[model samples]
Target: MVGRGTILGVLGVLMAACGTPQRQDSGSESVEGRVIRPAGLAFPYVKRPACPGEGCAYGTWLACDTVSVYAREADTTERAFYLAREEPFQVLAGAVHVTRPEVVVVTRPTHQIGFQESGVLFQQGDTLFVLDYIAEGFFDAWYRDSIIETEIFWPWEHWYPAKDYEYGGDVVQQGVASFWIQVRNGSGQEGWVPADRASLASANSLDPDPPRCPARAE
Candidate 1:
């Protein structure tokens, strides 16, 4: 039979290889990385230490001091949003420089709301840039919400072509729709357009990453 020590040692190696992170505590070290989270899809970024109250942003995610969600799941109803710098590095949506050790991600609040301020934050050289680059390829991004008893017959728009990235066919949805990604620039300018008609990069422009990530099916 395998000894307990041997079994534990094997488990440790497997966890490390899978990149399972250890728990982080407060006042951890700061991290930095290049904002290589894909150019086409806008990323949701917010400042650290968000406050809750009447002044808080709308909706459920950022509505409280903590970052918990009310999604339907048995074993995973609420997950803690880490305020530490190291935690965000694990869930970065895009690939960063393989040479940069890791994407030392920080300020990843549990909820992501799309606005002009949506983009990943990273340090490139001495500059602090907020990248709002939208991908060139066109895909259907849905904006959905439920209607209560009084909200029946509410006018809504659905994507007909869905490829043009245009919304028309104003009608009512029976159930509800999911959240949609709306691009906003650092200057507070907003627009929802096709890939060809997308607004310019929100801040300090980044030269397109040679070729896009082939693995990204979206």
Candidate 2:
């Protein structure tokens, strides 16, 4: 009969030969062993809505398991989402391979102001113009409402239409100086109003830069 110690020793050897339990591939393409980040590669994480069934929306602030990794390359950055398990390395590796042939990354700074800095305050029945100097045209306008309003304007558009404008926000980015102001109408919808149409609530309120209009013919 085998001694207890001998039997236990044999069992230990058998377990070692079997090796660590193989990780079940969660149907996702992943490596079986340790994953290492490539040299000189940097990835940044961004927050987004989690999977619908994961119950992340109602849970902790950062309870979402879905992580978006932006892998930066020489000229371009590739974006990928990974389902984080115990580790994110394996998922990252897979993302990097798929997004090869790096794409260039372009970034810009956004400037935001508060209510105090909003160009002017206007009331209902005022008409405001959406000016575009480059196009030399007034594309759209807003009919002011009664409620206090805010606006968010983009700097790039030569002409930004009021219909496309965002309302009820305190952020105003560097955009063309067309006298974009915030106003509300009877429907309670607020938007950017042109300074030319609406009179400022106070001279002390923020003022818009002079309109960059085309020069008059001699």
> What TM-score does each of the candidates earn?
0.17, 0.15
Clashing pairs in 2: 75-104, 76-103, 76-104, 144-184, 145-184, 145-185, 181-193
Model 1 score (lDDT): 0.19
The total of clashing pairs for model 2 equals 7
Show where candidate 1 strays beyond 4 Å.
1-81, 84-87, 92-168, 174-218
Against the reference, the lDDT scores of all candidates come to 0.19, 0.21
The lDDT leader among the candidates is 2
Tell me the tens digit of each residue's lDDT in model 2 across 1-218: 12211211211211112122222213222222432111222222111211111110111111023333333321124543332322212110100011110111112322333234444433222222221111112111111211122232332222245686543221111111222222232343332222211112212112232112223359
| Range of the 10 consecutive residues with the lowest summed lDDT in candidate 2 | 92-101
State the weakest 10-residue window (summed lDDT) of model 1.
145-154
Each candidate's root-mean-square deviation in Å? Answer: 24.9, 31.7
Model 2, stretches more than 4 Å misplaced?
1-63, 72-114, 118-218
